[model samples]
Target: MSMDPKILAFDVFGTVVDWHGSIAAEAKRLSLPVDPNEFAAAWRNGYKPAMAKVRSGTLPWTKIDDLHRMILDDILKTFNITSLSESQIHELNLVWHRLNPWLDTVEGLTKLKSKFTIVTLSNGNLGLLADMAKNAGLPWDLILSAEVFRHYKPDPETYLGVAEIFNVLPEQVMLVAAHKDDLLSANACGLQTAFIERPLEFGPNFSRQDLHREEFTTYHAKDLMDLAAQLNCK
Candidate 1:
């Protein structure tokens, strides 16, 4: 790497938190009729297409909370789950706000914070990220989101927005994410990129075959702790 990043922008959902496991646990706790794992997978599967609609102007700028509710309603019908009341459904949609962090998340972020300005770069809205940060005890210097940029990940605006906010060159910001496409997009925008491996991001039923190191990334780490070590953060 030519220059060490001053800002470490994180991709939140799967990279920092265990979304699949958290959702599945919540569903099981609620005693939903559908298989919890399958239910969680179905909900997450809708995320990209929902965002794509916004990107293509098929839907107006809708925050992730609304998008999540929309997906939840559709999946409920698909699973034939009609027992939950309106209040129950609404509360369930807020699972994103209550997601549990990966075991290494808080520690890693704390360590990294001592070295760089740590902030979120998630598609999740500000409120959602804030609530999650509070709930998970995540130590973030800032919570930036697609809602703030009005553009989702893989979009140049969202990646470059980080640099613009901090008044720095794109290469001075490193995007750390679990998804390859996200890192590739950041790399294309002249930002440093780091890939965080999350083999069980989708749940135990599914296997991610692309967890290996990729040429596009400046660093490829096993998890946030590993990333902290690689960055020499104590």
Candidate 2:
């Protein structure tokens, strides 16, 4: 891309952590009657539409953690599950906070930290991201969230907000994400883009068929490790 972006803003959900596996594992640990994989998929399936309500201004600014709970409640009902107590539900909702990072995430981020300022630009709330980073050992310089900008991904404000935070031009910031729409939004706002392949983001059984680089992204990486290597991070 450009010589080097001053700030590397990351999309957190699937790019950094194995959300599907993490959620599924939690479900398995709880011995939920539903299939862990399908439960994970069902929970995630509600994410976009939930965010759409906020994007369309139908709902006021809501964090992804709250959004996840709303979806989870519905999913539990849909699956005919009524065994979970209030405490159990609350604990289950915090699964996002306890997500495990990909194997390369900590080391790769450690290397990249030597060269650039790294931050999270996720739909997750600041509190949620902060807790997750601490729990997962993610070395983020800052945590930028939808809660900070009052807008979600694909919104220009969210992308430009990162530039504002670091006091840099849009082109001097790079958004590394597993989703194309996210990268496209960042690119439209003049930020550099890196597409990280997270083939099993949805779940292990489901294969991701799309892995090609799009015109919008500045870099395409197999994972955080590959991106660190490409950026010449020690």
Candidate 3:
């Protein structure tokens, strides 16, 4: 990389927000008749495999919203949840739109935005990402998603597409994400990668086992604030 990246594309779900806590809280509010933590874990465990079906052409190119709904239905059955009406289920599946940002998210992004374009590169659909930004006061310069590229993480297209969209080389774009799978994929496509440590992404009591540094990324930090400092952002 000859210069600092012009854009920092982030993975939103666990990277910027507390999805597990949000979902678990929502579940508890609804009186789901199951342990909220276990419910959240079961729901999240189905995420990647669900995306894999779409990525491998086994399932149609379904949006994350629909995929989430599919997983929700399966888990509802897993937990024997039969009380929710159709409308309730529909609204409940939209909980991803209301996820809460991490403690330093808004401020850190505000700081990073002072230095470079800050955007999102999540698997979440555009509407979901937009609503999350508005709800959480996430200061995104622009939003990019798998919906835009019709591809998900681990696909070279999603990583390289960010550069093409901005008219820059891949190296001039950096992907800031908590997942190594995401960073490794971006790195393989020649984009710089920054790994953010979001240890409580799954839940508050859960200990993350994959916070160690790897050679694939250009930088690693404890959170977005740490990432901003490492990047020399105010």
Q: Which residues of candidate 1, in runs, are more than 4 Å off?
A: none
Predicted structure with the largest lDDT when compared to the true one: 1
Mind sharing the TM-score for model 1? Answer: 0.99
Angstrom error of the Cα, residue 118, model 2: value is 0.4
The list of candidate 3 runs beyond 4 A from truth reads none
Best by TM-score: 1
lDDT of 2 by residue, 4-52 (tens): 8989999999999999999999999999999999999999999999999
Q: How many backbone clashes does candidate 3 have?
A: 0
lDDT of 1 by residue, 1-234 (tens): 567899999999999999999999999999999899999999999999999999999999999999999999999999999999999999999999999999989999999999999999999999999999999999999999999999988899999999999999999999999999999999999999999999999999898999988889999899889999989998
| CA lDDT of each prediction against the hidden true structure | 0.95, 0.93, 0.93
lDDT of model number 3: 0.93
lDDT string, candidate 3, 1-234, tens digits:
236899999999999999999999999999989999999999889999999999999998999999999999999999999999999999999899999999999999999999999899999999999999999999999999999999988789999999999999999999999999889889889999999998889897799999999988898899989989988996
TM-scores vs. true structure, each candidate: 0.99, 0.98, 0.97
Q: Which stretches of model 2 miss by more than 4 angstroms? A: none
